[model samples]
Target: MILPALLGLGTGLSLIVAIGAQNAFVLRQGIRRQHVLPVVLICGLTDALLEVLGVAGIGLVVERAPTLIEAIRWGGVLFLLWYAWGAVRRAMRPEALAAAQGSEASLKRTVLACLALTYLNPHVYLDTMVLMGSIGNAQGDPGRWWFALGGALASLGWFALLGYGARGLTRFFATPRSWQILEWCVAAIMVVIAARLAFGGIEV
Candidate 1:
């Protein structure tokens, strides 16, 4: 059970650590200090829900649906590219510090944005359900649940820390130049991930 839990934790953390749109949004919300808890809760709950679905044999379905997988892969790639472009545009057009100060994304918008961000990306299902599920399924009966629980816990832990930690960086992100640099970095990461997804054979 311990081994299964540890494996699940490692697997869960590994996937969560990736700099994807979901994480980007979470970090952005954290920096803005708007709807932080809601954002974290939604992300963590979504992860847990997906993991449960996967453990219930949805992973096999995904594996068998190669066409669906390919479609999602391409879709994810395109979405990432599009998102990267937006980030680059923002970087280039750096928002005024005063504007940044007054602008606060509504809670409803934040929740909806996060839901769309998490659910729309097929990669989330691929990673949490298919990939993580595959590992959980190998754990044998009751142990699989333990593994899944571990993975869910990891999501909870990581997202909470990420959202909370962003508060500490608010001072640094106050400067317009800092936001520009951060946006550029976000764009670079998104583009790199998109390229790898579109053309690279390396599997997650």
Candidate 2:
């Protein structure tokens, strides 16, 4: 059980630590110190819910449906490429970082955007539903639940740290260079994931 749990924790963090739209949004909100708590809760809870669903056998269903998987695969590839393009464009803009610091979106709007980012992204399904689920189920019966629990805990821990700890780096991200670097990292991660999905298969 301990081994499975630890495996889950490591795997969960590995997937979540990748710089994606959801993480970028969370980090931005964290830096701004606006609606951080709610945003973090929503992300953590949603991830936990998805992880549970995956571990409960949805992963198997996804495996059996090659057509559905193919559809999702292509869709994810397209969305990720588009997202990467946006990141690259933002990285090239001198004012992009400064502008984000000044904007104060309403909580309602922010929440809506947060939800959209979580659900609309195809990588979320691939990571949480397909990848993580299959991995967790591999742990064996009762141990798989322990793995899921560990993964859920990892999700909670990561978002809590990212959302609350972002303020500490508020000064660092103030520089346009920092923003450029961050956006470039996001672009790279998105492109790599997209490429892997398109050519390397969905095991990652």
Top lDDT hit? 1
Instruction: Superpose all Cα atoms of candidate 2 onto the true structure and report the RMSD in Å to 1 decimal.
Output: 3.1
What does candidate 2's lDDT look like per residue over 65-153, in tens digits? 77776777787678678878977998999686689667777999889867866775556777887888999988989998989999999
Write down the RMSD of all candidates, one decimal each.
Answer: 2.2, 3.1
> Which candidate number has the best TM-score?
1
TM-score of 1: 0.88
Residue-level lDDT for 37 in candidate 1: 98
Residue-level error in angstroms, candidate 1, position 18: 3.1
Could you tell me which residue pairs clash in candidate 2?
none
